[model samples]
Target: MADTPNGATPQQPAQVKMQVLAQYIRDLSFENIVAQKGTGGDVKPDVQVQVGLDAKKRTAENQYEVLSKYNITSKNKETGDVLFAMEVEYGGVFLIEGVPEQQLHPFLMIECPRMLFPFVRRIVSDMTRDGGFPALNLDTVDFMTIYRNEIERRQRESSAAQPTNA
Candidate 1:
């Protein structure tokens, strides 16, 4: 450790602490379109998944809430008919400390959701299995990549919204 000119040692960063206070499913919906419409023989399905993330500061000190939303759709590959559609919004209340102010947003958006992903995956798998389809195990999400893409998207939107001085 290097000492400053005043002979004081550099201060070490505070240890980061994170705890999950609570987790819940905010909303969920599943529709079996194939059952309603009755698909013909040899139905091959194609699945698509979309995910969204949001975070908010709670009123309590050092508390935050994060939400992960998933939209899943399955269609028959040959006929282009909808087989199933599902949406799930899961939330987690977290107690977080020691992270710097400049890093809180990223931490909340990325780390918090990463922590809550397992529960979300389980819920999705259960819901699918209970809804009459084979269990759907979601692939692991890359929160860092998602965060970078979101930042780039916001920058592009902000720049496009700006007025040209010319």
Candidate 2:
């Protein structure tokens, strides 16, 4: 390792610390359309999952709340009929320290949700299985890609909103 002047070691930035204070389901809904209708049988299901992430600072110092919302729908591919629909909003309370101010937003959006995803996945699986359907094991979500896409979308919208000289 290269040393600084007088052979002193280079300083290292503080290591970031994060802790999950609490995590729980904020809301959940499961509608079994198949049971109600009893229409589709042995039909291939097309499942669509939509995800949304949000974070807010808590009243307590160094605490923040992150929410992961999922809307899932399963439809018979051939019939275009819904088999099931599910919505879940899971939240986590985090105590974060040593993150730079500029990096905090991305940190909250990416890292906190990464920590909470497994639990959310499990809950979804359990809910679907208990609803008399095949357990839905959700694929891992790419938080960084989602964050980047959202930022790009917002930038495009902002640019489009600005008035240009005719």
Query: Highest lDDT, which number?
Result: 2
lDDT of 2 by residue, 79-156 (tens): 999999999999999999999999999999999999999999999999999999999999999999989999999999
lDDT tens digits, residues 25-117, model 1?
A: 999999988778787798888889888999999999999999999999988899889888999999999999999999999999899999999
- Local lDDT at 135 for model 2: 99
In candidate 2, stretches whose alpha carbon ends up further than 4 angstroms from where it belongs are: 1-3, 6-10
- Give TM-scores for every candidate, taking all chains together and pairing residue i with residue i: 0.93, 0.93
Residue 29, candidate 1: alpha-carbon lDDT: 99
lDDT of each: 0.93, 0.96
